[model samples]
Target chain A: MTTAVLQERTHYLNNGYGLKSWLLTKDHKRIAVLYFITISIFFALGGVFASLIRLELVTPAGDLVSSETYNKLFTMHGVIMVFFFLIPSVPATMGNFFLPMMIGARDLAFPKINLLSWYLLIAGGGFAIFAMMAGGVDTGWTFYTPYSTTYSNTYVIATALGIFIAGFSSILTGLNFIVTVHRMRAPGMTWFKMPLFVWANYATGVIQVLGTPVIAVTLVLVFCERVFHIGIFDPALGGDPVLFQHLFWFYSHPAVYIMVLPAMGVISELVSTFSRKPIFGYPFVAFSSVAIAVIGFLVWGHHLFVSGQSLYAGLVFSFLSYFVAIPSAIKVFNWTATLYKGSISYATPMLYAFGFIGLFTIGGLTGLFVAALGIDVHVTDTYFVIAHFHYVMVGGTVMAYLGGVHYWWPKMTGRMYPEGWAKLSALFIFVGFNLTFFPQFILGYLGMPRRYHAYPPEFQVLHVASTAGATVLAVGYILPAIYLAWSLRYGPVAGSNPWGATGLEWATPSPPPTHNFDRIPVVTHEAYDYTAVPQEVEVV
Target chain B: MSSEAHAHAEETLALREQFDTAEQQKDASTLGMWIFLITEIMFFGGMFAAYTIYRSAYPTVFAVASSSLNVTIGAINTCVLLLSSFTMVMAVRAGQMGKRNMIIIFLILTLIFGCIFLGVKAYEWNEKYVEHHMPGQAAFHLEGTPLQGPAKIFFSLYFAMTGLHALHMVVGVGILLTLIVQTRAKKFSAEYFTPIDISGLYWHFVDVIWIFLFPLLYLIDRHLPK
Candidate 1:
């Protein structure tokens, strides 16, 4: 009731409202909302591309499109999902909106630079869309040499440049978040007391800061090779094609953490809130985020295990890959343990959280399968690999993202959607996701390679199942879009602290004021110390 | 609680009580700078890792490639960048002293030295082009050269590493020019020169990257027969 009055009084919309207000706004929340809209559009575009891929894969043959079109389909899917959707999904949207608020800061360390990051993202997204319109890239997202450098007739330069600019956006966002989290916390908020989401984002920020630039330079090299025929990774000019894989995966392998670590953070909050418990092993979970980020960098060579890497190096990377799993396993065990003996409620967010736990477990275990050198040799570049990553990227990351969106939707927009439909969509997504990707694991195990436009007739049954599942997945995904938009206009008005969560963000009004705080909060208690019974206050 | 009264009182105060002391601000900024520098190290670290792998693979080619690089020009550029780092440090010191003129002078000096570094780099690149040593072109060859294919890899990496470093240097110069303009406006002083301090960190980082680049690209494996 008090916060409701505050919300009505302190509107976040710029006083001088215009295109320039939105465009030139230095507020982090405004920029975050900017990122939210842009990433959603890209996600829809990428979803369309994904659906086309699934439709074609429904049968063993590439029946829906030509080989050239199929190549472009998967390539567009990979490029858009990776650069546009997954990498920026959680961090730029939710992290930007919440990190400063969680830490009791008015804004990120550099607000103008924050705005610049959004612009860069838009410019990059624009370039990517332009590339798609210009008959799309077909070299897969990896852009492996000679094919990318010499053979491809598609718009390689535009796509690579898009990724390059997007990389800078990631770099700047990481820098701002890192600085804000480290420097801008309230007086009593110690590092240990900070929420696990912050810790996870801190780790994600580290990877972004450290890894994005390497990819930026690598993409620039790919661009240069395509434009000027410079032989950085091209084999025809005596370049080592494998080296491109090394350099690309060096950033890209850790990039997997960049995509997942933030989602792990979101799950930490959801599990704790819905289960009504302080996260089990909060310190371990916090440190594990950092540990995963650190060890994730060392294990990139695992991607190159079958890429003709040195035998000794492959073994070293394999061991490191196993080491990286320890931190992830700690997180998974901690989440499960948090749910044990706790009053777990199956809200929409909680259902998706459960989905995340199950799917991410399968994804993580399959990751171990690929991390082991011998098994990797058997399944590298197969549909198994495809399934493994989709489980992590799609099943794990997207589920957590949707869950987070639902969990935070009331806070972000001051309205609550129909909970029943939200839960149904969660179930649909989980079942549809498994149906769509699980068969690929078997297909891949049975010696089917990925990236091919066609396949043997024997795989048709599995393919058809996958296509049917994809149709379900499309519904699962589109429902959220429809409902969330509807909720913006007509859903029940949510009070502050609707979830009864313990964090500074919920301490403020729903859809917080522009400066974020009318008066800066003095955070005296630890994050997520939700041990007391809930208190209900009437709306004003 | 009246809005006008609150606004008048808050605006009139020279500093807010949110930060208990100036030291906290300094500490936070310093920590932020250190974290940022760590990222810069990782950025250059990627390039250095690539160089090491290729250099080990084609030691002879790398050696010839190193020798072919205009070491004299690189050395000069190195000194110019190093000196610019010194000037940048001095600029920060001037800001600390509230000496606007001295800050402007030091920034301009840093900018000049940055231009000189890029100028030398362009000259060296042109020389490589003339010698038919640029990677991926018809003029490029390691035939009769000891390392052969690896040698081509060496030049490819060399161009990439140094070329990227040079681009950063150019960017640093542009940043310095902006700082110079801001300094002339007297926007920064003893109390607030965060822009200069931040730029100094970036400048030092660029310098440090070249410090590693010089040894890794220009000095490594330079003794092998061509």
Candidate 2:
């Protein structure tokens, strides 16, 4: 106990004092906190926008706000949620905090670049906030040109610039992750011996590096078209607007993988740990992530099936889109098989992982419905499309993100959260999320278009249900914020390897030292080798 | 201690705490620069794809507008950029050989050629301004042009692509100036010249972009009817 106390005394939290230590920190863990705090604010702001959008839709009329305001609300909701919150949620915070620890490195390959990436996110957020303050952009998060470039009397350039700057931040983080994975692994840590979380992130990093720059250039063209009257995507000036969709979705579609792949990684960790078994078909799961990232790029044309593309092109894209789902199915099946006949525990993380699988399955299956030409003609730009993405992004990624946070909270804060409350919140989120989005699937099939302030009286019942569920889902999200914060002072001190996990991160002290490991770990076994005998040893 | 031993000690001092050895650090840095270059390719690749699609759609207008650009100046600037890239290569070689004076001299030469390329670009842009060929201005009007709309687009892309290349050149100059100051400060020796090598990579990359831009913009319709 004395030695545990001594180790705790010098951990990362108390190693330094004051704001400067935190703000200027080159430590990947501290940088993760910087990202965490910023993205949390973005989440709150996005949630407020979401709440307003829902409240306005609770009736058949636009009662709460003007139509323009409603449009701005959903636009900000998506812009803040997708770019500011979801994309950075897992990879920046958890990945940065844990990737080095998992690989047994003192720090990321380029610690200063990691810090710069966080700052770039903030600077980008500043531009976005400035644009919002100057009157928000109303072109929606897709920023489809013609409306965005030539017509919308909103702050399009400022918002696009914000997203553009943030793209560089993503690129730099991806670069850091790739190099770290390639060059920073400790001796004896072969590629397959590395944890699935690292593999998932490596795949996400590849997408970030290769896919983000295209968007950066795409937005640059948008900026030029707006500011300098470049004729790239404007039909009035002899350009094809369909080309805009092609280029935008070219990056933005793979961007969906960017948002979910890291969360899939977190779920891989949670399912294996809570089930007390190695992941089933580990190589298949690892390779599927890479497959998804690559295959994701070829399926963007599915978004444009209804956009006057050639009939033959749509057929090819539809076929490719169906092909992309095979890898995702493989992951889901592997996770389910990992649970069969295993010692499964319904920890809060496990509950949320279960939530992710159920919701992502519904989401992924519906993606095919839209990927088909005939069905997409009926459902594209409707609430069904909205519901489909929310399921995958919100239900899938956010659920895994929360679950991973709970599973790692003890290690992150050196304190155990209240398990009963955490599980209750998990249940709240699952039930509330279904209530929120499941009705929209029906509403969208009924031909209700999205981005509207008013709809038919028949749609009111579903919208009301979604609004009510949003309130519950909001509570589900807020509970973690309350308890996780409260646990810092009042909860039990969790020792290293509290769950008796097998990864190198668990080998260090809970709340690891400034340099992640006192001595670099040499890997000698495959990931999730739970059958090995245990012995307690000081990391240093 | 012998001078050789003293130099070995200095090399050890140059190693960072994060790396296990100098070789690993160098390899990581080189790989990182290569990855960054790939992103740059993708960044420019978007515009290239756009240009290709539009150019194929209106080949005659694109060729006519291509002829309007001064091929002589474009050809000269291309040569100038190629020379700068060659000098950058010499700078990297000098750094590898520990010839500090040669490194400095070659780097300055590269910087000079880069400036000359920019100066020629500014002069060409000035000529376009006088001829009312710049896009987005009220005075902008293409005269006696076939497919005026497509011709306008060709100029729009010409400016956007080359203008972006110029912006990269400006950034390159700033980086070279920093490297120059750092070299004078003796912050690097031959054993610790990763920054110089990476800068060489970036400089050569900028030249390669112009190599593509020169052909696509200046040489595309050289044989077309004036």
Candidate 3:
């Protein structure tokens, strides 16, 4: 298939060529690109922290560094990975770029506020960097009470403040997306007919708006306790530390959905496009996103099952946790059915999509083990829990993120990355990720507790294997960063509709013009209509 | 055929209109404001949930802590806030009716009431400070109180919850001041009063939060042990 001819259009990139233009720009696409770059840097920094952690664990003894340094390493890793990498990865980048175009709007409802979110992210990132430079915080990302409020000698306040500001950034983004999706749809594009990606983002936006603020307030309380010696979370002064956990997870648990839902949305598009089939049970998939968002809130107490919660309350949380999985299962099954006996392609994006399916399955199934009261008691803080979340968060969300990034790179930058290298990196990531995390599951089941600087000699084999996998995973992650950067200047021009996919974004020029469209499109066909052939001829 | 060409030109001229209709624009903006307000509710909802669980667990301490609160100041603040809401509504109505002077007048009235609310809050907080009721201070004691450790819990929550609410009030006042300036500049008209409407929604929301706080904090221990 040849590239189709589009109308001659003036490029937005050529319209401006200075830093000031980008800094002051209201263009959502540019803002998305800006987010992509900023988040990539933070991800690399976070990966470095992870590498230090894995390296320290390569041996049985705590010979690599003191326990204090090790604690700082994991703390920095968790904080950066959760806040800077996972939460903002897909939504700020892909959602910002495509949501407006998907709904036939020129820009978000409040473009200035949209820009303000970026500034907030930067300010927050700066505080985080400052904390790192000024002897990093050691209170693990959860900032579990007593430790965070009273024990930690590091700059907990600085880090917590950073996260608080970043939380507002997310809230603003959610607010923008909600308004855009609600009010900006093109004529005739009903909610049901909208693409599943939009549906997923909409659900995520809801969680972002509602769930993020709880964590913000919790962090504020933590900060106050630290600075003012307030006894909110300190048991010695009449504060209940358990209450802190309840409040923290109330947001953090749904935050996991905030991290994954967008990736799931990305997977829906990739599955349908590559399989050449309309998504099986589209409404189920769409509603499941909403269901997950709502159900996600009720089950946060599952994190407190072993934390001295009332037995009855624990049971309630445990049961609610099981119910949450039903919607997730529906999503996985629908994706599988979408791929059933269709004209399948082994494109790079599809490979990553396939990776997402396999890895997310392992990650999600293991979550059930942790949710079960008896099982969670045995492995609550062990490597088992670590492996379970990494499988879901890193293996699942990150794979889908890379897939979406590759899938949209052509449209986003008007350049195609090297397909062969892309496929090779995808394979390496799968192998390396499995190597790094899969053995942790064994180590966890064998009673190796997480967050320790030292361990018994018996766990060394799995530890070494995990460390080796981290090195490969590091390479796997770095390769795309190199090639994607290289592709921007030297690769062949990606004309509009590089993948021959069906979405409103594909209907416009690659690296879309500032106003998005010369005229708003009137939608007459449903999304993912890949079965029909086109009559228009290629320009090239 | 030439006559038909003239009719076609007339229709074509009308086809390139922006925004489908006025109602469409209004609906979109209104929906956007409501979604934003929902986010605000969620923001405060977190604090409320925390307050609820803690208060339920220690009803006696919460009541004793409530008894210490100056009901006169709190009630006055509440009335001031409710009246501010009324003034804000009138301001929005003035904007809608294209009455610029009335809009400014009511907005100013709303600002005054807001200041009055903050003033009462300051006096109440000062009273707590003077009485050594503030958390983490050396003056905190519960020997004679109905609830032992729970009184401290009550005061801890009391400061955190009301302090956060006061912080929001300050923010709202700043926003209203901005609206006042913008109103003076003639930025809003009958056709474009989104700012006023959204601000009113937010002001009313803050008022609603105080309503919940009053019952939870001020009225929880009104009938204390004699």
**Individual DockQ of the candidates?**
0.41, 0.76, 0.43
Query: lDDT tens digits, residues A1-540, model 3?
Result: 122222255666666879998998888888898999999999999999999899889888899889999999999999998998899999999999988888787777667778899999999989988999999999889999999999889989999999999998998898888877877788888898798999999999999988998898888888877776556677875668998999999999999999999999999999987887889999999999999999999999989878999999999999999999999999999999998997788889999999999999999999999999999999999999999999999988999999999999988877788988999999899999999999999999999999999999999999999999999899999999999999877666776787777888888888788878777888877778875434132311
Residue-wise C-alpha lDDT for candidate 1, range A1-540, written one tens digit per residue: 333443455546423478888889877777888888888888889989888887777777677899999899899999999999899999999999899989888788778778988889888988989999989999999998878878899999999999989988998889888878877887788998898999999999999988887887777778877776666676654567787788899899999999999999999999998888999999999999999999998988998887789999999999999999999999999999999998777789989899999999999999999999999999999999999999999988899999999988888887888898898898889889999999999999998899886899998888888888888898999999999999877788777788888878888777777767777777777778875436343211
As for candidate 2, its clashing pairs are: none
Docking class for model 2 is medium
TM-score of 2: 0.97
State each model's CA lDDT, in order.
0.84, 0.89, 0.85
Model 3 has a DockQ score of 0.43
RMSD of 1: 3.2
What is the per-residue lDDT of model 2 for residues B1-226, given as tens digits with 9 covering 90 to 100?
A: 3445545654653665677777778888998999999999999999999999999998877877887888888988899999999999999998888788888888899999999999999999899889988877667777667566787788889999999999999999998888888888776777888999999999999899999999898887676566
The lowest-lDDT stretch of 10 consecutive residues in candidate 3 chain B is B12-21
Best by TM-score: 2
Per-residue accuracy of model 2 over A307-397 as CA lDDT, tens digit each: 8999999999999999999999999999999999977778788899999999999999999999989999999999999999999999999
TM-score of every model?
0.93, 0.97, 0.95
Candidate 2 residue-wise lDDT at A291: 99
Evaluated against the true structure, the overall lDDT of model 2 is 0.89
True contacts kept of 3: 0.47
Query: Clash pairs of candidate 1?
Result: none
Q: Output per-candidate TM-scores for chain A, rounded to 2 decimals.
A: 0.97, 0.97, 0.97
